[model samples]
Target: MSEPSLQHPLTGKRILVTQADAFMGPVLCEVLEEQGATVIASREDIADPDAPRRIVDQAGSVDILVANLAVPAPSSRVGDVSAGEWRDTFATMVDPLPRLMQAVLPGMREQGHGRVLVMGSASALRGMKRASTYSAARGAQMAWTQSVGVELAPENIQVNLIAQNFVDNPTYFPPEIQENPRFQERLKREVPLGRLVSAREDAQFAAYLCSDAASCFVGQVFPVCGGWVNR
Candidate 1:
């Protein structure tokens, strides 16, 4: 195990954060930079099959890959889920995992140390109404992380995931939704924390996972949803 710096554990580390404009991408990049890491933020639309590889190629080598992939979750019930919607959801969230891994793994292997963190959703960890398509895609991400995390562990590349929900992000719980009384009641009733996990809090945890101190963690699905998954 390496002794990581307390204040700047990510110093000297070059990290690539995908979908830099959405989901947890913005905050993750901000916190990682504050931790002294060189963040290669990519805002590329990865729906095109070649985009993931292109993004990686453009960024060159990186010590970490933060797959911050997301889309506006579809709210169709299970019976109403259309094939196009299902495929699009997976295209955005699930398909890019392997593509990004394929692009980045070789460099990581050469370096003999790397980290991959997927900013996923707790909707996959727990059941949600009208979220079948989204949850299925997120579930695939978690399973892929578990499998690849172990496979790459021996090579010193740690792969893990943060299954998060009820986090303060513009995508899911924007200010307008947060200010609603009904949503506030739902938060109090459903979430054990009685509030959305702040963006900084979630980003800080992500920083830890990307740090040298987190090398031992592999194939782990860490829930950062204000205890919503457990409850």
Candidate 2:
């Protein structure tokens, strides 16, 4: 194994991070910057139809695109899933991905190399209660990634995803839940790692994957759920 160092393989790389104010954006930006990357943080929600293209257009010559998309996890039962809910979830998570890729591909193709990493969810990997819409949307992201990864591999542009759950973040495991003893017990009983994966751990992994060192990984769904979704 290689010795650990503070310097990241992404040193000097120009990376564009989407949804920069939410989800895993802040931490991802922090870690990527710490590793010497010049991060272009886009605070746009990306729900607007033309936002993806505009964002990519705004950031020209990007070496990496971190599609860090996120929305509130829907708790409506599969039977109670409404058309509006389904459409909205897909709109929030799935639709923008292709647009973003298409917009950025030309520049990456020009450069002859690039990386696209999707910040996704583990709920898509397994059946979860009352998360049908959210899981389906996330699954769509992964499925699109799988097809695109192979398509872009010839251009030396890597597309991949990090399907994660049960991590220490403000979105899912908020302060109130973390303070609950029951939640802590459940965390220990459920996750094999026996705790929430730190934000830095997850962010660092993302940084490495976006780096040149992770070129071998393509269209791969790496679970960062601390063994929560072992399958």
Candidate 3:
């Protein structure tokens, strides 16, 4: 492993963070930059089949790829889940992933070292009401990560994901939800941690995963759900 600066775990690393303005993108980019990495932030929606390849081409060679893909969770009941809705969910969250991986691998393979971290959800790690579509999509993300992470392991490309929920983010748990009494009670009762994990806390963990120190953790799904999924 290379000697990294204690104050800058990612110093000299070039990282590409997709969906730069959403999910954990902003905070993730901030943390990576603070750790001295060159962050190419992309705010484009990758639902288009061609977008992933185009985005990866635009970013060129990066030491790390932060696939911060996300979309609003569908609240449609299982019985009423439309074909359009289900296809759209996978199109938005699952389809473009392989393109991005395929596009980035050639460069990573040449360099002999790279990292890919998916800022995914824990909804798939556990069950939830009215979240069948969301959970399935997230499950596909983790499953793909496992397969690709292993396939690319010998090439020195580490792939892993953070299966997270109950984290303080505008997307999943907004301020309004946090302020609601019922939601607060639910948080207290459901999450063993009894609170939402801060966005910074999650991003900090992501930074470590992108660093040289975390090279040994290939294809693993690290849960960061404050124990909500355990229940």
Candidate 4:
């Protein structure tokens, strides 16, 4: 670990990162902690309606909530999308969102300040073949962030989403797939960055957002996809 900065942006802040073992959760937790946050890393299943509140309650007072949720993206075409896939995707990614808000908002309100950052996907930003179900769920997450971000801004609570794609992580881009020649060609043809965004780069930005410096942003969907959204 690098030496701690003289001024820790997240010093004394209590951050709760959900689904700590998945998607961007591990990196987010690692970066936030390095920045001096007391992190509550939970790897619980939040699909149950009560799980969100339970997790929040167990963590007690939270200064920031990182809604880092994910599941294996399904590539079923629109015509082949199963009802089960749709329900499960939303259940895992979308459903827990509002429940988490409800659980944490009251505590934040009492404190007069809070931050909620959703780790979402850019699949919802652009069209992709055979991603109907996964995209819709991610799209719902983006929409929810926009709506709730505005609603909570007046209360000094900031809600935002990071719509990311083509980032280097084991979940979406494992080593074997990244080493493939065809995948390299795709990177050249697609991502403007011509490479996967480093996981630390992404996590560092997330840490900044969770810090006090990001108070001006509200309900914004920042794309961190190596310019993939534009392509």
Q: TM-scores of all models?
A: 0.96, 0.94, 0.96, 0.95
Off by over 4 Å in 1: 1-4, 229-231
Candidate 2, run of 10 with poorest lDDT: 1-10
1 or 4, greater by TM-score? 1
| Alpha carbon RMSD to native, model 1 | 2.1
Q: Write the per-residue lDDT of candidate 2 for residues 1-231, one digit (tens) a residue.
A: 243355757776889999898889999999998988889999987989899999988887789999999888889988899999999888889999989988998899888999999999888888888999999999998899899998889889899999998878777888998999999998888888888899999999999898777899888898888776244
Assess each prediction's global lDDT (C-alpha) against the native.
0.92, 0.88, 0.90, 0.92
Model 4, 1-231: lDDT tens digits are: 333354678888899999999888888889998889999999899898999999999999999999998989999979999999999999999999999999999999999999999999999988999999999999999999999999999999999999999998878898999999999999998988899999999999899999888999999999898886253
Question: For candidate 3, lDDT tens digit of each residue in 11-42?
Answer: 88999999899888899999999998999999
Candidate 3 residues lying further than 4 Å off, grouped into runs, are 1-3, 229-231
Per-model clash counts, in order, read 0, 0, 0, 0
Angstrom error of the Cα, residue 204, model 3: value is 0.3
Query: Which lDDT value does model 2 have at 207?
Result: 90
**Inter-residue clash pairs, candidate 2:** none
Task: After the best TM-score superposition of candidate 2, give how far the Cα of residue 52 lies from its true spot, in angstroms.
Answer: 0.4
**Residue 102 shift from truth in candidate 3, angstroms:** 0.9
